[model samples]
Target: MVYQRARDQAELSAIQEAYHLVSKRMEGVPGLLGNELLRSAHDPSGLVVMSRWSDLAAFQAWEQGSEHRADTAPLRPYQDTRMEIPFGVYEVDAAY
Candidate 1:
């Protein structure tokens, strides 16, 4: 998940646009199952781009690839800088 903050509605729109572009670029990418753009109910400026991959190995492979930075650059400026780490990776322990 990548945490993001949009100061206002205009910024939010831009973020959404960027998300869509990134999604398009990721189409058919190996191991990328799906992704979502989530906005906070309490704090409208708070946003998160969550992507599901087949496994850690797959995600790491893409992240380390040459196109990774360019593909995700659009949202870089909006990343939540307050947190020490603005992103995280997790494995499902249990799911219904």
Candidate 2:
């Protein structure tokens, strides 16, 4: 997940637009299951782009690839700088 913070409504709209464009660009990418854009109820400026992959290797492969930075550049400016690490990785340990 990548944390994002928009300074105001205009920036928030831009963030959402960028997220959708990125999502479209990522369609059919190998090992990418899907992704979602989430908003915080308490803090409307807060947002997250959470993506699911088939495995860690798949995600790492994409992250380290040449297109990674270019593909996500649109959203880089809004990354939550307040957090020491604005992103995280996790694997499913259990399922219902």
Give Cα-based local distance difference scores for all models: 0.94, 0.92
lDDT of 1 by residue, 1-96 (tens): 999999988999999999999899889888999999999999888999999999999999999999999989999999988779999999999999
Best by TM-score: 1
| Predicted candidate 2 versus true structure: per-residue lDDT over 2-92, tens digit per residue | 9999989899999999998888888887899999999989988889999999999999999999988988888899999988999989999
Q: How many clashes show up in model 2?
A: 0
Please name the candidate that would achieve the greatest lDDT relative to the true structure: 1
lDDT of 2: 0.92
Q: Lowest summed-lDDT stretch of 10 residues in model 1? A: 74-83
